[model samples]
Target: MAKRVLILSSSPRRGGNSDRLCDEFLRGAAEAGHQVEKIFLRDCTIHYCTGCGLCSREGRPCPQQDDAARIIEKMVCADVIVMASPVYFYTMSAQMKTLIDRSCARYYTEISGKEFYLLLTAAEPDRQLMLRTVDTFQGFFDCLEEAHLRRSILCPGVWNVGEIEGHAALQEACEAGRNC
Candidate 1:
């Protein structure tokens, strides 16, 4: 069966380590006969959430009109969600965090119950340190009922744009996506 796979690449810079892995994942998933689409947050005009509390109030809709709602709608429709981010300051990038915050309106109703796969990259070499970023994602995962974290590929010790190139983790990402 062909599954709908939506990949959110949150790297502020295109072709960044995590984003590169997302490309590989896309390639593998496509070869596996899945309908895959990747959303590069860098290209999207995502406005910061204003916390107006309207979206929670009976279809009042978000006061700020931007790409967030559209992205959330795609997220709601996807069978698999790949969240790829480059970790900085021991956490996800600001773009990814902003997207999560913007989803506050439809989180419970729309963003829950999907298979999640994480692709994270960081300069820190220690896997334990990288797990901190995964832990951060776990906090978000805990809020979404039935959100299964199927797998995660963490690429540490990568700082430059092309630093992660040719790494074995890239192949692992392809394999993971193919299996999905």
Candidate 2:
């Protein structure tokens, strides 16, 4: 069976390590016959969450009238949501974090039961911190009715474009994608 997979890539550099990982993952998914869509956050205009809570209260749905809401809609439509970002200061990029914060409406209604995968790359290779970041997703995503976290790929010590060219784990990431 083919699944619709949406990948939100937050890397600003083209063909960067994070981008390469995403490409590998998508390639595996495509080879498995799944439909995949990758959205680059750097090219999109998305604002940070204002904490207005209007999306949860008045149903305003993301006060920032930019591309954030549309992206969320794509996320809702997909069977799997893969967030690929380069970690900054031991956390996800601001672009990725902002999009997640702005997706409050989905927390309650839209994508309540959707599956999610996280792909994080960092300059420092620390499995413990990367696992912690993956765990942080639980706070916002665990409440969904039937949400399942299939995998979280943390490719560390990659800070340049093409740095992951010959990394062995990249193959594992592709395999992970096939299973998605």
Candidate 3:
């Protein structure tokens, strides 16, 4: 079965290792016959959440009303979501985190049940941080009745642009997408 997969590249740095990894993942997934679309965060205007709880009360959605909502609509319709980002300060980049925060409407409405995966690169070369981040995602998806984590690929120490081109993990990510 062909699945609709959305790849959200939340790295503000273009052509960075994280973006490269996301490209690999999308290639792999597409080769597997899944429909894939990638939305680069750097190209969009995504504002941070204000904790207004507006989504809960009136379904006002994110107040920013920028391109993030458009991406969120795609996310709601996707069968799988791949969030690709670089770890900053032991967490996901601000760009990605803000997108996640703005996704409160999905939670409040419980309108979609979708699988999610994380593709991350970091400078610290620590695997635990990646695992913890994936765990955080796990908790978020726990609300969906049939949601399941597909995968989380963390390629640490990829601190430079295009540095992940020849990495074995990059190839693995591609293959994973192909098989997805």
The candidate that wins on lDDT is 1
lDDT of each: 0.90, 0.81, 0.79
In TM-score terms, which candidate is top?
A: 1
Stretches of candidate 3 off by over 4 Å are: 61-63, 108-111, 143-145
Whole-model lDDT, model 2: 0.81
Task: List, residue by residue over 134-176, the lDDT tens digit for candidate 1.
Answer: 9899988888878999999999989999999888889999998
Q: What is the RMSD of candidate 1?
A: 1.1
lDDT comparing candidate 3 with the true structure: 0.79
TM-score for all models, in order of appearance: 0.96, 0.91, 0.89
Clashes of each: 0, 0, 3
If ranked by lDDT, best first, what sequence of candidates would result? Answer: 1, 2, 3
Candidate 2 per-residue lDDT, tens place, 25-138, comes to: 899999999999999898999887788877777877565778988898898899998888787776677888888787785554578667888888877777677776676676
lDDT of 3 by residue, 1-180 (tens): 999989989888888898888898898888889999998988998887788887867867556768877877888888888888787776677887787777786562452567777888887677776776666666656755677677788887677788777888788779878877
Best-to-worst order by TM-score is 1, 2, 3
Candidate 3 lDDT at 43 equals 90
Poorest lDDT segment (10 consecutive residues) of candidate 2: 105-114
